[model samples]
Target: MALLHRAELRPTKLDLLAAWLPSRRWFHGPAGADIVRVAGFRFDDPAGAVGIETMLVRAGDGSVHQVPLTYRGAPLEGADGWLVGTTDHSVLGPRWVYDGCGDPVYAAALAAAVLAGTGQAEEFFEVDGERKYREPSMTIASSGAGDAPVPAVGPPRRVVDADPALIVTDSVELVVLRCLDDGGGERAGAMLTGTWPGQPTPLPLAYAVPR
Candidate 1:
């Protein structure tokens, strides 16, 4: 079996981000914008062949965002559904990017991290302390058949200031959404963020909840 090398020669987290950020849909700037790594941490697969990293980055304009990524030594077949991108390694020669949510290796690692209490976010906040708008809380639920519809777990709650840890449930499929605060200081909008796994240009599902 192949194994991940353990050595300092591995590129720093920022180095990987510098090469990756430009390719994301949420990235708002041109390729030349400077990116600074504010914080980063790694997650390891049990077999030692895959490594996952969650990075917090601040762009030149000082916008902060979170990026979750997985790195593998070789391509994982049957994982096309989760592929994000493949590129020359600059140092390692060739590399493949997989969506951490679908790739089994990454999924297992992520689930373990969440269960172990290692990958949860401690706090969340809005940009510039804005109160009129806010982001939604994200949750990952599992399906038995791998193609089950996501159930409405609960009423939409405020995530404008929640630092939620990534959650992995045995029965729930993952759900991503955005919550907007109504004029009454309560959440009023629910917008679904679809599952893409490795899709590079993912589009959000149309807003479905009542305004």
Candidate 2:
């Protein structure tokens, strides 16, 4: 389960993305375009130290892009290039946000989800010390065999930012779809697909193939 606090965020997530997305080679939207969060889901960190979230955002021109982000209390070592920006969280204090593609925690969590057929985390909102269940903006499922075994994912040996961002680890190659297309993406191997508002049909989000 994922616990969220009812707190404010300085330069909210979208604001940070608006300035960061244009720099990515795979981002086709206008530079500095306004971005609005359309939908998203989260994967729990087994150790509960990192915050993992994947967001679908619509640009000013109606183009939708997928952005996977990870939040940390401190900067990730040797990941200066992948740093999205820093933001102040009311309850959590300072947060270091980075593109999840370059974070090993995200790579491992994603690989586990796809290879082990796990789903998104159950979310809860905490307000005044009380916890309330919150419905996820989107839902996801994996095409992997339920009984399949998942290999331990190591640090990313390489990260390529493209239409489908690639995270090449020692055990598998993780493909994260950067754009949302009606045609969906071609299946590669074990993959995770999601459905959100206005999209009744499941769309490919990410996939994993053995290294």
Candidate 3:
């Protein structure tokens, strides 16, 4: 089952950002906001070969942003259109940007994780204590099947008054959880947590559920 390796990786977090952030549509910077490495973590693919990382970086203005990246050994030919960058391994180089949404390796791994019942993220609920989960805007690239269905929690309820639970699935169960936090900021505060079939559990709080 396709997996990511998490050992002896060479690229420093900054190297990753220099090659990644500029390629994303959501990256808000003047193209000169020098990136300062902050913190990051690696997740092992269930197959134990591919590597997924969630990195936090601060720009020159002290703005912090999260960058989620996937790495692969050889080039994923014909998939260059989906990649952000590629370079030879100076120290085991020869890596390619595996778009989590479109890269087949990552797509299947994520699907398996979701199907295995382990992949969760947080979303903002309304003020009445209701949580609404939306499908991510990103697409997983793979010759595999389409996206797994995200289960609904019944009709929309009051965000502040109801004590609801969050669940996700893809023909099989993925994650289930009760209320974690109240709505705050410009949105509600609902965190998601679960484990994938063969991969490490992603930190649900690491990313705000993509709107």
- Ordered by TM-score, highest first, the candidates read 2, 3, 1
> Across residues 88-128, which tens digit of lDDT does each residue of candidate 1 receive?
55545566766454455544444333223233222332334
lDDT per residue for candidate 3 within 19-86, as digits (tens), equals 66666554545676778755443444656566565455666654445455567787766666456666
TM-scores of all candidate predictions against the true structure: 0.45, 0.95, 0.47
Minimal lDDT window, size 10, model 2:
180-189
lDDT tens readout by residue for model 2, 1-211: 9999888999899989988988877776766567988999999999999999999998777667889999999999999999999999999999999999999999999998888877888999987779999999998888894746798899999999787888999889999899886444586788788889999898888899977
Per-candidate Cα lDDT values, in order, are 0.41, 0.88, 0.41
Q: Could you give the candidate ranking by lDDT, starting with the highest?
A: 2, 1, 3
Best by lDDT: 2
Model 3 alpha-carbon drift over 4 Å, by segment = 1-13, 108-211
Give me the overall lDDT of model 1. Answer: 0.41
How many pairs of residues in model 1 come into backbone collision? 8
